[model samples]
Target: MQRPPRPSAPRRRMPSPGTGLTPLLLAALAFAITALLTLGAYNSARHVAQANLQNTFEYRSRDAHLALVRRMAVYEEVLRGVQGYLRGSVNISRKEFADYFSVLRLDESFPGIEALGIASIIPPGQLERHEQAVRREGYASYTVHPPGPRPVYTSVTHIEPFNGRNLRAFGFDMFSEPVRRAAMEAARDTGQAAVTGKVVLVQESGWDNKPGVLMYLPVYRAGLPAQTVEQRRAAIFGWVYSPFRMNDLMRGLLGEHSGEVELRIYDGAQPGAEDLLYLSPGTAPGRRPMFQRTDVIEMRGRPWTVVFSSTPALEAQRDTVRPLVIGLTGIGVGFLLGVVVWLLASERGRALKLAEKMTLELRQSYIRIEAEQRRMRVILQNAYDAFVASDAKGRITDWNIKATQLFGWTEREALGRPISDLLVPPDQRERHVRGFRRFANCGSGPVMSAPTEVTAQRNDGSLVQVEVAVAALPTPDGYGASAFVRDITPRKEAEERERQRQQRLDETREALQRAQKLEAVGKLTGGVAHDFNNLLHIISANVQLVLRSPNKQQQRLQSILDAVERGSKLSAQLLAFARRQPLHPQVVDTARLIERMDSLLHRAAGEGVELRHTVQPGLWNTLVDPNQLENVLLNLVINARDAIEGRGSITIALSNADLDGDALPDPEMAPGQYVLATVSDTGRGMAPEVMERAFEPFFTTKPEGKGTGLGLSMAHGFVKQSGGHIQLASEVGRGTTVSIYLPRCLREIAEGVMTPGR
Candidate 1:
């Protein structure tokens, strides 16, 4: 019975599932990831915004600096113009200076310029006359006195009558004032612009008590030494000085943005001193300086400082960004939590098992989606074409990096703006919108293919040409459109340049063709003229012998002789035209040659046309066939006269010119000095077709009876044979210019006397 009781019962214990740590671990991880992401995003956004702000400030600062420099350049230009007028040997007077000053006043850019005046170290006698003029004008307040070894007088201040006030301190010695003295001495030493530190003027009887800085630019005579102490070169024309009120200069420089920013301009040489240019009201009057002593010398020599501080409004703007970031972060966390909770609660056991098996796959899918989105964004940003997408209503939905670069606008600034606003000029906006709409519906238009040339408007209101391509994308509710725009101005310009180059090449080829044809004609004409000359000589001898015979009739013989003499003259003309006649070559001074030929050339040109000679005085002597050259001149004049069709001008210019290897028509030609003779005519120019055959024999524009058409052919042959080259340039409705270059004679010719013929 006791053993049976011992085995009575083994108490049954309930099985228990372990407390869930997996869910807790997942929640904790989610929190950690959310916190890390928020912090990283906050830092990245802050850095980007800060960088944008700094870039804007730097751009504005540079603009202000350049504006000041440009203003100074303008002043220098005005002064240079005045100096030019003075150097023209014209008398410099008060009236002339006043007129120049009036011009300066009329310039809107120089708004705050106070005065512009000229001063000079006066000679002893001129000083008295200046003083007398001032006294006679009833300007008792004006005073003049001698200064240094050379007496100098300051003119009566021009501001006196305008301000209705008289200041009698005109005789004040400018050399005694330390600021003015330093500026003057620097000008004398450097022969450049010299500036002085701020100083208060004791002679400011009419002007308010405002300290100013002085600038001086030196003026020296053309031949005088720039810097010297000797009496002969001691004439230091008093400095052309201008005084700028420190406060006014600083205020004007600040412009419309004065309240939005703080500025400080410091003299780097003197640090921790009261020479501050400007300080905003926000800055304490006596607070510790933001800049250290070392910072002052950083910009020494050309010492300047520009301190920029953001306004309270900008600070508030920065402060507002923080709450927005926090709000966005909270929204993100809630969305993530909702997604996880939904997955956990709806299908606890089944989802957990499936998630465990497919975790890696799901993660890979998410990573791929993210990478694709990033790739798309990068492609849009870096593409050279300006990509823009718009909604159905023509409101901009997206803009790419190239759009920003081309239009000077950022994505943030351009988004949600009207697509037509940027792409259409004011005059064509309606038409452009209609065209865009048509393309959207039809899927084809002028700009639908590869990018075609069009103009786009920039943020700064500048127009630039672009090649544009467009596509319409179908959407569930409406249509979206994208445009690809590429800048094509440079390409268009290059194409135009190529077209012009081709045109010039064509013109040159035609000219060469004409010249070749002329050479062939000249050769033919020369042969014919040589034969004709021999025949004419034989006939002349026979006629002379018949005239001396006893059986000859006197009247008949006279008539025959006359006819023979006329025939002889005609033969001579033919020889000249063919360039086959004997020539006497000589070293002729071109200047004298032109002067001597002026009358004859004018006579040949006739009364309707003007013949002018612009022969340079020192024209180099050229060795050429003078008789042939003269014939060449005559032929050119005749051609020019015919081209004129009655009334025009013919200009003959003779000058010395250098022809280098690079300038030669071909490698066979040598480089050296040459005497250039140019014959230019303002006439009814020949067309391209006519010019192409102008030099050919028997290709004359004249009537058959008027000309043999051997003029230019002969001219070209003669010039080439005399060791020279000729070029012809012409344009329809413009004129023609023929240039001949004869090699300069560098050596003296041996003199030879001509003996009597046997």
Candidate 2:
């Protein structure tokens, strides 16, 4: 500690010369720079707000146009259906036409189409007869209006619902008006639906005369070819047309009012009263909108101009800004600048002490920065992934220890080598070189600041999958790039395996649903078959007894007996499909059984099919009913014979298979050894839809009265009841295969073996 000095007396000093003017001058300079910055910020904010408001207006315009076009398309479909009926029918009757329209319920279901009507194209001479023909259909006073002699006359002959609104247009001549005639002629010549321009419809009364349009679809004669304009006119029979009011259609589509935007629609390019079809409430002559845009939409070969404008309420909501924030920010910044200027000029001695303190602080900052660099070096050396640094030319400048371990290259060997040549695959080396040049020239690349998946080559010439992220480092000359790479081979393989497992699960679920449905149908069929079989048994016994008592062969009695025998056979087939037939099961070798049936199978297959059997030695034995097994084989063999059109081969293969818990052939089969029996035919196979229902009883592709559709169904039921699974695969025009997997038996072949025919 040191001793304290004596206090000195305070001295008063006068202001220096010109010091008062200096403060005023400094304050004026600060205000000028602050004002310039504040004005620039305000202008930029206003411009940005205006651009955002313009985009909002344009988006709304497109949405309104799409809504109008989509609604008009729905109305076109209604006209096409009516046109099709007229062309298809030979003669149109009054009752038939009325019944068709009554089912449509046009007024209740479709609000836009006011009424549907038919207009006849009549000659001047036959006009009287047409009127009489209409009167006979209960319309007494019908006549073609605009009565005059012309080359052709189109008069409304029939209109549906027979109401006051539709009756008003019963005799109006559509050919007299130019606007309606243009649409009709287009429909006849082009064979398509056409819409007319703006006009007051004939259906309107005194105050309801709104702007409306008509849609016409032409109907040609039944047997004529209307390929040209001249031929189409000669073959024209009539027209199916409908009328629509603009106000009613717009109301149903966009409601009574659009809250945020005003709309105007015009018939064509011009925007005058004659061409203007519609205008919203606030879009009248004198109202000026804040933001507006125009779009043109095409409907049925006619262009409609649509203009969308933002209302005052919408503009105010979108463009509003906070004035208080701007004012406060400007004031705060000005005050801070004034304080800084005053401190600099008035406290020169204090400034000197501050400079000395700043020098000492700078020295401490250098020590802290050096310590941070050391920490970063430690992080790079101990990181799990490789971190490499390269120059603008892609020469490796720095390599971490992880890089050496990953690529099997020493740091000494990796330094000063081109990055592409050292790590990138040979096929991708040229592409990497081109990308590096572009990055150096433009200071940007697609791979910068993002992770990318790529293949990299190691020193041993093996490729590895890696995920790389690159960052640009600012250098004294230009810029350098640094990359961090991580191996991702294991992750990719895991993702692929998971995808395969999910696919198998989906297939299993679909198969299970089909099996459940078929099982329910089989149960129902079995109950019905059991009851019918009892009735047939009683009938056959009585018929035989009656014939014996008569002691004569009556033809009718013989027919009755034959019918009973057929019914019993059908019942047995149903029982087989349901797996309810009586069975005595025993272990048997599939190879020996097939050898016994070799000759019979050839006879059943016919000369067109070449049958062959390939049986594996030491095949596992399966426990099944011998009689049922023989029946199943006969059904399968006959089915294959029918499938072949001319000449083909049918092969039977027998083998042994094993099923695991994770890899099961079918969801219903247990994990164990199985005996597989497959019957394959090279013939015109079934389509996908046919193959899906191939196992259902009474479902078949064969013609009626030629064969019963219970062959495959019976085989499916028998195999499932015998603790086995069945699978079928077929492609049209290629072939068909039916595979049966039965549970294997471990018992020795020592019991009595049943012959194939028995």
Candidate 3:
């Protein structure tokens, strides 16, 4: 709104004599300070990177050591199982022992076991007799190996699978050698497992030689005193032992463990070339490790020294200059700022009005930028999902509020930590590294910017299910990454619960349909059986009458009468299955009913099946035929006995359950208080398809001639006719449980009744 100044010849102001060099001096000072700052920042960054490298090396070393300990412990436990098997019997034959060992499937269970064998201590006198006994068993070429005998010779009498390289160890005299003899003696004297020192295994072929060790678990004569050292040595029968090759052993123990950490194992407590059992492949000779640590792990009383060292690959990562890149970026920005200040200071001779206007504009711009930054921080802090950004080296650069809450690591703790170490699970870190490497090298990676469900780690060492959307960020130096992560654990849990509920719902519906089908079959069978019974009655009467009147045909008529009688009996069984048998219904107490059957039920279950009863006091009463109920219980116990193999237990548990309107156990059952009598067996369970048709007539899982297949069908008919619902539940290896829910007697009584399901 102000009038423009009149145009005039611009005055060429002369530079002041005192201020002439001030701009140059200020510019030089600014640059010098900036250079010093940049140098300090770079040095600090390098120091921090070195510190991180040391920490990473230590972590990997500890991990490798722990892994070795765990793998060895598992092998020791397996040896214990073998030792237990030997002590369980006194006369274990060669075939029996071989079959037992074959079940172990050593390669699949634990990859490095060279052989599991039994070494028998051969007194000098019994050598010929032992050879004769082994020869009779089929190893014609078997003989004591190494062709020498000590005071007490021990030969591997049984080693399996009797094929492959394991065959080479057969008849190998272990007690003749000092290393093997020492471990065997340790096991016998201490009555505990022991491991031998480093040795070339007898199982090694001529083409290969790997450091090997043997684990020995002593076996003593059954029913002998082996508690003390002298007693154990005297009664010791032999030892169950296994051999291991260190190269294959370590490979199995430490799968895909990165080469950043070099592993070396020594057989004894000290690390020496003579005692070196294993040296990890790819270790650069003469390349001194940047980080090294030594620890000893005791293996079955034998100390194993493990050495872990950092290699050049680890050093390369530490020398990446990522921290220097970050520091320089920051310092360069400050340096440029200093140069701008120098330039502004140099323009002091300009118009005061214009200078004031430019200063105001800069102040406004700075305020606006600061306000925008604050706004951004507030938005990030309040975002719903966790937000994290990392540099190309996978170092966390920025973290937001949601990330802090989700990961349990505060912003300060997570800022410079590797993203994989902080968030990626231990098992998945390799994949994370590969993805980042691919993006950095090829500028492309796995489906970036698309949400993917993955497992993530928390600071507390627990895991979380997260859906993360990652985007690659191209920077001046390399590729970086930003991710939005949402915790999906709650949603996954909800889905699981819903899935289970739906499964249960489907099962109940299927059971209801099966029950309806059985009911229809029962009605049809009952009508047909009734007509057949009437026709048989008439035929029997006519045949008997004819037999009385005839002489020559009397034998044939008598045979016809016998045939009719058998048919009539079969019809009676059919009527029973149909629940059409005549019965006198009476009020029965559920608990008292089981109490009266104690002797009868036990006799039916036999000694193998431990019969048990759990009768709930004050059980509800139901109206059912007393005799029919007794028959049902006896049949159930007998059926349960047949269902079980060897020793098992059958429990008849009685409890009162309420089937309310909200969630009736079955659609066939009305809302009411019911008496539940559950007959559960620790026996072979039924498959789902078998359980569905279990109530059908002539459906049996038993051998063809063993059962009539009418037991469950008749029982089902009896329960349904008595106004009850039956439910069957089973798992393939676990067991089976059958429950019968009978409506309580409407009339009031002091005691109650129960239904059966087995």
Top-lDDT candidate index: 3
Report the lDDT tens digits of candidate 3 across residue range 655-743.
Answer: 98886554587776788888898888888888999998787776678886687567777778778878888788989766788788877
Candidate 2, residues 429-450, lDDT tens digits: the string is 9999988887766555655423
In model 3, the clashing pairs are 590-752, 590-753, 620-752, 620-753, 621-752, 621-753
lDDT agreement with native, every candidate = 0.60, 0.74, 0.75
- What is the Cα-based TM-score of model 3? 0.42
Query: Can you give the lDDT of residue 229 in candidate 1?
Result: 38
Rank by lDDT, highest first: 3, 2, 1
Q: Which residue pairs show collisions in model 1?
A: none
Clashes of 1: 0
**Inter-residue clash pairs, candidate 2:** none
The local lDDT score (0 to 100) that residue 39 gets in candidate 1 is 65
Q: Give lDDT tens digits, candidate 1, residues 1-758.
A: 45555555878975555447666777677767767665665565566556544544544455455545545544454443343334312235556556555544422444434445454544555655655665677766545533544433434233211221123234444555666676667655654456665565433554576555555555554334332334213645555655555555555554554554455555445533566644555654544432211223221013555455555443333433643454365346556555345424633654465456346544554564465445455556655467788876677887888788888889998899887786677777898788767655644454432234667788888889876545455455456677667788888899999999999999999998898768866865674565456556656665776768757656556766665775665555456545575667777766766666777888889999999888777667888767667778888998888889768999999988886654675465579888889999998877888877666544577885677666776777677767788778899888899999899998554466221111
User: Which ranges in model 1 have alpha carbons more than 4 Å from their true place?
Assistant: 1-19, 88-91, 124-130, 145-172, 201-208, 221-233, 277-314, 317-320, 327-332, 336-758
